[model samples]
Target chain A: MAGKQLFIVTGATGGFGSAILRQINLLYGEDAVIIACGRNKPKLDDVTKGFAAGVKHISVDFAERQGLKERCQAIFDLAAGETFSAAYLYNNHGLASDVTRLAQDFDDSAEIEDYFFLNLTSFQVLTAVFLKNFSGVPHTCVNISSKCAVVAFPSMSLYCTGKAARLMLYKCLAAENPEVKVLNYSPGLMLTTMTENFHNTVAVDSTKKTFQAFKEGNLYVDTDESAKKMLGIVKEGSFTSGEQIDFHDC
Target chain B: MAGKQLFIVTGATGGFGSAILRQINLLYGEDAVIIACGRNKPKLDDVTKGFAAGVKHISVDFAERQGLKERCQAIFDLAAGETFSAAYLYNNHGLASDVTRLAQDFDDSAEIEDYFFLNLTSFQVLTAVFLKNFSGVPHTCVNISSKCAVVAFPSMSLYCTGKAARLMLYKCLAAENPEVKVLNYSPGLMLTTMTENFHNTVAVDSTKKTFQAFKEGNLYVDTDESAKKMLGIVKEGSFTSGEQIDFHDC
Candidate 1:
């Protein structure tokens, strides 16, 4: 039996992630089978609340790094002895450093590890598990890359480094596995909770400029529209494996 | 005083790192005070033994992941109440994963973390400390990058990802601090303990080909030559900040 067309959305509760999931739900309705993975219960519940059907919320904290191995195993073991196809895995979850300014970058290793944990380590662990469990399946993993991946800003050093690692990791995975497609999808500037949180918490001068841009609606894209465009790109099947596509490109 | 003209080299016992150190010793003698940092006391001793007068060996294991903060503190504390200028920091320490094949990739997170720890984490920690302690000093930090940083290969996923992170981290640092120039110097392919260890330990088909190339001298530059060329690039004052200069380019 062909197992359900599963679409795994990490950071499902986040603004961009939920937007993507909402669109997927609209597109697929009862046919939608999404594994909405996130940390917070209320936020996860909120994201999946409007879904008509085929939504499963699994609360897994990438930061704490608990239950990841068991979770991935359970994800695949349930599809044991069946032809299961994971259509897509969206590595949408990301965390910017609490210490945003480069000058004031963390001397503490634990604090710095937080950025690597969320951005690079967690994504890599998940991707490795995905590849191991579903090598036969043809699927695409869209990494929600950022401007930091390509350009290094004044204060966003941690973000840039992590996203850069994510992008290169995608490229390596793409080269290794022909069946699995990897796209480093830099979403440009979007008004997301994560981005909002950066400006709210850090209050760096550069982040202040970002806040201004958001207020002016001059720098960032509409989150919903950008999500729609991303999905549209996926649906169109135009992206080559291992290619980096920006929101404007879409 | 010129503050002893300190040049700290991590992975001092390693081929590339030692080569760089040896060249510095030959060029500057007492003028260039080299701090050869590595894990092995004997190897570090061997590397710096023949040096005439300006060599200090500091043993700090990256795998230990302990006392680094204190060690770094002690390093700069020696320069307290004295005028000092750090000329260069060679972040040359590196570690390769044992699992060479992507199909046989590490299931254990610790193994994966090890690859990242030695390659990216330790480097970043030291760099952060370096920049913090010596922000006023003009210095260059050369990361001993690999072809893996730019090009992806089968079974080298862990290395590629970690090195890519290192490259981008360097870029971020260069952008943030004008005095601290960061170079992701991909030495192309080099005959080093790490590269030799890859094929020697894990005999995958892909790595076997690399081994064959190394045996026949078909691919890779000699490690010593590459080191000299890298030093030459620094000496020439041609490199722009945040530049990725390979040995071939130099």
Candidate 2:
């Protein structure tokens, strides 16, 4: 009980996110205190029911800008008065941009601001509070980044931009703090609802064709496999701090 | 004057923006229609006062969310019913981040949102409207980028994150629209008020020392010279679309 491990996973009820939770439960079992965060309360509750570890679910809508700080603070407060041997934060929550529109079609300031508020701002706030709260513990921070973070995809202007911004933010965080271990993990294109929506709705022909090929060839990565690989990387801890590690690279 | 050039420069009152304006004025002279945008009306008027070209000043506060689309639309409306041999958008406006704090210190949602509104959101909006309005013309869009876009610096998280996002945004734009010439120009460390603020207020010692060396060794690039090189790059039409051309790379 004194050497308990802590894990906080955002977007924990989603397909890839749930895989991560399962991987943690498999790896750490009763030694872990898993805090799973998702917007849907019933879904979150359902997802954590099978885990062997003590799992706590927090209903958090990252899109809502009001009381965001307080919300983040509440997340950290869950571990109050308890000392962990190690803490892990998997920053896995983000929404895909409106893919039906081209890059130049985004002329509305309010729309762009709203997109970033959920993707980047709330993400940053959560990470900051996590780091502050777990200052004494050896913490590992993972940004569930994407291949689009480094490569440009047509009709994914907002998603690419947000990912790139997030990667840089984590890089800066790593540079500023040498104590914490940071990893920008680009989980390969997995067969998730998000990817399904992207395949169906992307406006550009070239981009659509690429996704079409992936689907036809059945080349999309398995969510559970990719999640397990990421967990393996974390266990090995060979990645350079602040570097982006893609799924295929392993 | 039938094949006259159109040049739109934002942050026109600032040091680098003014230099770009002067370079365009020198290159095109009376054959250019220049739209200079900045928040300070008097300063904008003063900056364009000496230009030999036909210059128009638009007072815009990119930070303000209210009516931002209308403001960007107003910029393009100035070039309505006008045809040009080549139209250039010097997306040269951006503010430095608050360097007095570390990357993990930015926990407030509104503060982060406000910073990006000025640095990235308005920048994207302005570029989108510019490209849409000038669709018929041979358009060249330049995002006045920084080395920070690719490299993370301590105590400069917001600036680096914003630049990285903007760069990826332009990359997507270039991919989506191959007809438009796109360039991400990283104007090297220049002697400007922005640099002065950064050099003075940066919280990290390593970052502060690097700037100190630049200041002590007189290693900062001249704003006018760097601006001219960027213009020359535009004239040469040599860089790969969406690639970042740094100051020393030439």
Candidate 3:
């Protein structure tokens, strides 16, 4: 048990994040221990309680600098420990733009900063920290991306551009480091807070229509289904590093 | 003429930026006014001195937010003025990462933040500003990218990821707005300050080897050559919006 299988999850309180945690537990059972990270401690605790292998809840605000660095250090220390395991990191935290339209009178600069920080910068930092600190256990990372990375849409500039950066980051990591396996997975349109809460997220008419369509079942995938599909990719061991597996394709 | 042709350029002090400015002047002469923007006031003035139409040198630090916002607003105000021409905003500003390896002892957070700010945020802010303030004259944005955007690289993570964001941003812009012509051009190993200043820039062995190869005439295109090739793209008018034009291919 020296090198146990440990799965590290960010955004563990979110729909897809929790689903992925559940799936990992279901598949690996007692073999997998989860390090579930999120801002909401109570929520993360609630979500991980039922899992058999159990979860180590890490309460860290990714948006805050000190907290993020501390959390990252903790994770690195864990990875470098004697009892540490082969790690699988799922970078699942992200949010859509504050406004659907760029022309909005609100703080566009702040929005852009937030989007890049949350989606690209933090991920980059964490990846760097992880890769630099890895001792011997096998490592893999899955970056939760969107189809917006492939097809940039109107009113989706911030999300589109940020997700695009995320995909490229994963690609670069996989290409540069052969030892680490990485995946940029677009789980399709999920019925998560990012999609369903768009009524509160953006005020523009164009995006509102799109969100309406999502609600009306014109398009969207359930989180659990995609989570299972993603695991299927891992099970086959056929996913190459830097593979971008879309939900529809799976 | 109340509404003539004005080419807006960022990083007006750099090699490719200056070359493109000179090329535009050489081709269009008095017919094209250059809104040359850069940090160095004296350099910008010196560069634009001989041009007939003259350059509106906007000395603004891109990495600094307050100055950037003020300068951007000023540029928009100038563009909206009756004297301003049918504007063409050329986003030519980009910085190679300060170091080659991302896993350095130096501040990775600060490095990532600076790269995103200078390369992506400023470009994005300017684009949003430009598009939102447009008054119906032909406008095209040429973003100076690199082959790194297409190919991910080790030690070039910051540039690679940022340029990837830039390319995707152009794609999104072209997709969303049919009227705005956008080109993401990879200059293909230009012999610019970005290339020649590598010894002073990065301390990694891999990058040093690549730079040494560049120094040995094993690689790198001349700025003037790439500039001429790029102008050919603009003159040909066959290049589609959102098209990625590479120097060798062109």
* Best model per lDDT: 2
Give the CAPRI class of candidate 2.
high
Candidate 3 matches the true fold with a TM-score of 0.90
Q: Write the per-residue lDDT of candidate 2 for residues B1-250, one digit (tens) a residue.
A: 3568999998888889999988888987988899888778887777778778988878877889999989988987887887888889999887889999987899999999999999999989988888877666788999999999999999999999999999999999999988999999999999899999999999999999999999999999999899999999998998899989999898
What 10-residue stretch in candidate 1 chain A is worst by lDDT?
A77-86
Encode model 2's per-residue lDDT on A1-250: one tens digit a residue. 3579999999899879999998898888988998889877788778777788888878888888899989988877888888899999999998989999988899899899999999999999999888888667898999999999999999999999999999999999999989888999999999898999999999999999989999999999998899999988987888899999999988
Model with the higher DockQ, candidate 2 or 3: 2
**Residue B131 of candidate 2: its Cα lDDT?**
80
Tens-place lDDT per residue, model 1, B1-250, is 4665777788888778888888887766777777778777787778778786477777767654666667766655545564555568788877776544672255555566666766777778887777666556677788888777777666677777787788888887777677666777887677777777776765347657766776797676777778778877776767888868887765
lDDT of each: 0.73, 0.90, 0.75
lDDT per residue (tens digit) for residues B114-189 in model 3: 7798889888888777766667677788889888787766666667788888888888778667777788888888
Best to worst by DockQ, what's the order? 2, 1, 3
TM-score versus the correct structure, for each prediction: 0.91, 0.98, 0.90
Q: What DockQ do you compute for every candidate structure?
A: 0.51, 0.90, 0.46
lDDT of 1 at B204: 49
lDDT of 2: 0.90
